[model samples]
Target: MKKNLIMSFVLSTLLVTVLSGCGAASKSTTGTADDTKAPAATTTTKSEKSTTLRIGYQKYGTVNFLKANGELDKALKEKGITIQWTEFPGGPQLLEAMNVGSIDVGHTGEAPPIFAQAAGTPLVYLGHEPASPASEAILIPEKSEIKSVAELKGKKVALNKGSNVHYLLVKQLEKAGLKYEDIQVVFLPPADARAAFEKGSVDAWVIWDPFFSAAETSAKAKILADGKDTVANHEFYLATRNYAENNKETVKIVLDQLAKVDTWSKDHPKELAETLSPQLGIDVPSLERAAKRRAYGIQPIDDALINEQQKIADTFFKLGLIPKEIKVKDAVLPATK
Candidate 1:
């Protein structure tokens, strides 16, 4: 009877041990099932549709008109794409945002992208606005002695560095039979440059519209030389390489709308000024003068435009404005469809 009891106890212990082992295995399987479900939930969250199209733009360009019109939103809404506009003070800042991947598309003057490219920012030229040569100019106070670009020798010339106007000043100086070193170049953005010009701290202010128009009307400034006889200040629409390559269709939509707006602006200067004045905080007449001066021709990128851009890059590099040589063609997108 004692031996039978010992065998029974041993069997009971075996059963308990096996059951404990099976319990642990079951718990392990349950944990794995939980882990598998968690991944699926995460995947679903990540797979949710991304539907925002972010565009970077300056206050002075066609993108501003696009934002004000709301037509781009209407056009893209059907495709599950919504427009998000970011305003930048200038092209360099706009491209800076693009370089950091904060913006998908932007518009800038001819020089900003070159500077951005020299700094290793990956960009592609998507389209361009026809050169509005008269829109940008070198201005002198109405009563100042500086009559011509040649008279600017040894004078304080205020302008924004790395801006399209920078190249304009350089070319204007060369055209006036003066070298860059012959003048005192004071680098300032539009606001500060305008301030300095008003204060008479700078001899001449190199600027663009509606600032140019405002200066002419408000400050009684005279144009020493406009872009007419200088560099072609072709405004460029730019996109990140990744965005341009992946979203050609969306880009095409934007280009089409911009083309329409450009044409409309050309035909209706007073209307464009009326639409822009309240937003720009400038008077209607100044805005009207600016609108009329603008060419309002946005075109697709081509080899000719690329070559012209290369000249700008080369000029900046030669002048030691950009750190290194950059090829503009490296960033040219497939011809706008």
Candidate 2:
């Protein structure tokens, strides 16, 4: 009886030892699984934090307002992203930066993108700026008697080629029942156009923005016609397809911030002018006038807008401004639903 009890106790002890060892092995296996998952979690966290976005803009536009307020940078900083801002003189120059991948996104008037698209640039239109017809016009000296665009025939017309004003000139000529060949086209940038206009080197000058306001105030220029008679004068915001596709969150943040700035500008025109005067080195009143004439808003590039742009492209191609027919819809962002 004593031997049987001792044997039973030994059997029970061995069984308990074997069960405890199995439990410890199971716990070790669980710990190893947890260690394997930890690296994947770390990698996911690092990936979420590794993105940076770059944006490009110009002076005297909605992007400037967004940049000045720092709202975009603030919104992006919350997402563990950084925004790099670059400024250009005009839309053509901005598109130039975009073509070379120096900028991921940019804003420009309707004409620059058409020109770039015609040249086979790989840019996608992300959005459209609110249309403002009064912001663009053809101006002549106040004392001049060139009453109509028809009189511009055989005269040297100063315009920024491939700029928004280029479209204005073309449309105005067509309105007057004249061909583009009827006029002596002199392609001058805004600054040079101003100098030429002031020196009486050009019979007429087509321009936009602070320059238009400056010429109206300082140079006593008379408006031959405004863009209202020609085109809608819409500005476009564009990004590279690769950048926009890869960075959707960043683009949304940017568009949201820009929309906010547009709303703020509409409510506070005088304050906006006061804010921009010193920055642009232009007078407050001039900036104020320009601000009122300028429309500020951000809108997605939809099918309608793309079709309208296509019409402009078609016009340019027919007039030989663009070398070939361009399908504007192809350059719209893929996520443009």
Q: Count the backbone clashes (under 3 Å) in each candidate.
A: 0, 0
Which stretches in model 1 have alpha-carbon errors above 4 Å? 1-50
Which pairs in model 1 have colliding backbones?
none
lDDT of residue 183 for candidate 1: 96
TM-score for each model: 0.83, 0.82
lDDT of 1 at 137: 92
Q: How does candidate 2 fare on TM-score?
A: 0.82
Model 1, 171-265: lDDT tens digits are 98888899899999998878889999999999999888888999998889998889996788888888887777777788888999998888887
Candidate 2 lDDT over 1-337, as tens digits, reads 9999999999999997754442121111111122111011011131342355546666678877776677777788788776666655567766765665556777889999999988876788888787888999999988898999999999999988898888888889999999999999998878789999999999999998877987898899999999995788897778877777767778877888888889999888789889987766778887788889988778888888888888889989988889999888788766783
lDDT of 2 at 251: 80
Among these predictions, the greatest TM-score belongs to 1
